[model samples]
Target: MKPTGNTILVTGGTSGIGRALAEAFHARGNQVIVAGRRQALLDELAAQRPGLVGWPLDLDDPASLRRLADAVRERFPALNVLVASAGISRPEDMAGDCWDGFDAEAIVTTNVLGVLRATAAFLPMLKRRPHATIMATSSSLAFVPRADFPAYCASKAFLHSWLQSLRHQLRKVPVEVLELAPPYVRTELTGRGQAGDPRAMPLDAHVAEVMALLGRQDHPRGEVLVERDHARRWAERAGRYDATFVAMNPD
Candidate 1:
């Protein structure tokens, strides 16, 4: 949050927005720890960057997060920022004959419960710092559901509401809470093809905008929203919710 001189831990830092943010912070001379499930990727990233620490983390497993918490507490006692960027997305069609709750459960598990767990694990330490910050990634679709990805949109919607209460509760604690509601970005979150999708915003481009936002402290209501995300994010306020939902969900 300070742009530099703070220790930060970024979950899902092996790829996508998480990796970009970790690298951006590392470039700013912050002590960065990238937590991910891939040991090899973590090792490779750390090998390429001397000060970028990579620790194994499995968001679905509580024991794994516990281990990560212990490691961070012992090694980086000054950690003041947590970027809970780990998440998954899946398209589901409830009308399908094979429709079940499997994909929905996974989405809620990682996007909803996982974020809560990560926050619980690090919030105490964050509270100890005078200028601590908690940032979690949501989605622009949270404001208006995408019919194809019902569960994913719902998961992000949950975070959007949860973060408001979290920010209010922590307001007096003086720890800033930010919700990063990114628009459709070119990433492997949905699968390999999304990374090459021409319609998706470039990963680096989105991260660049986000970094600029962070540096400027331009977030309103602790929402670090990019320009592209504004339309969908404020669709309801703009009297365009129904139209926006139809546009995004048109099959």
Candidate 2:
């Protein structure tokens, strides 16, 4: 939350938003450890950036998450910031008879359960720090569901509620719970070529805005919503929830 100087662990740090934040934090003098499922990618990132630590982790596996937490506590005792950015998004056809090809279960496990387990594992260590931050990468779609990715949107909605409760419960503690609701950004989370999509916000530009918001010296709120996402952010408050939902998912 302080922007720099603290040891931070970022899940899904191999690509997309996670990777951008990791690089930015590393550049700002934070001891950044990037955790991802790909060892080669992590190694490459570490090699490319001096002092950037890479740790291989599988968020879907509870054992792997526990091991990662142990390793972090033993290796980086000063770790105080955690970015739970690991997630999966896949299209689901409700009209289809069979669910053989759909990834509903995997999406829920990775997005919801993954965040819960990771936070549980690292929370004790975080609480010990003088100042700590737990940031989860929810999506703007949480407020407005996308028909094709229903499960993904629902998972983020669950996170929105969970994070609010977590933040309130930890209000008296040194830990800070933050939710990052990103708009449709140029990222590979959807699939290949998405990072170059004209409809999506450029990854660098999104990260710049995110960093600027986080670095605010005045008052930093628990939720980080960008200007581009204002329409989705205010859908319910503006009495356009029904219209926005229909517009977001025409299919």
Candidate 3:
């Protein structure tokens, strides 16, 4: 789908990749709506971008998602694109006795369930447009598991699978499904340690690659591996990806 002149809503637009995408879309002259749970952040984004709309949405809550759908229909009925960029990452030590605690649950609820909620809520609106598209953010970890961040990886893997299936199912519809699989990048979601890590791509560089990828008519079957990186390529090396992961994390 063409990037410009479309009305788009990006969930988790308060920070990280979501915010960067919102800014990019706004700059391209699209009607961009930034949705997130934080009202203050939404206000800040609106203050910065004149035509941008900021909507407070909590994807974790189904009722809230439903309400958001109604709001979008009433306020921005021409909405034709959704960027499921809202997500969370946590080091899930499943070996620990407290695996059932809040952190693990929060990760699942926000990363996995939240995507599902947003998709279902806005699907009807997307259907209204003749050339709509849904972009789901997967990750390099979706292909290669980081043992320590198992929960986050699993959620992304599930989304990747779901997007693949959704793409097949929507073949007859105007709505297009695209999966964006990013490698580690310099962003707040990666934690401060990842900020200084040489392996992480600069935030601007990562988003620029993604923007170029999205501009193309070709939608990658399962993933769009942004720019070449050893770690990212190794993540998809079939059954052998594990050995590469171990080598990188060797103690």
lDDT of each: 0.94, 0.91, 0.84
Kindly list the per-residue Cα lDDT of model 3 for residues 1-251, writing each as its tens digit. Answer: 78798999999988988999899989999999999999999999999999899988998777778778888899999999999999999886667787865776788899888888888888878987966999988887877777788788888889889998999998888898988777888887958887677878887888888788778764457356676543654555556676877865576
- Which candidate number would show the highest lDDT if scored against the true structure? 1
lDDT of 2 by residue, 1-251 (tens): 79778999999999989999999999999999999999999999999999999999999878888889889989999999999999999988888887664498899999999999889999999999977999999999998888899899999999999999999999999999999999999999999878789999999998898889889932246889888877998899999999999888775
List the candidates ranked by TM-score, beginning with the highest. 1, 2, 3
TM-score of each: 0.98, 0.96, 0.92
Better of 2 and 3 by TM-score: 2
User: Cα RMSD (Å) per model?
Assistant: 0.8, 1.4, 1.9
Model 1: number of backbone collisions: 0
- Report the Cα lDDT for candidate 2: 0.91
State the displacement of the C-alpha of residue 200, model 1, in Å, after optimal TM-score superposition.
Answer: 1.0
Residues forming the 10-long window of minimal summed lDDT in candidate 2: 217-226
Which portions of model 1 show Cα errors greater than 4 Å?
none
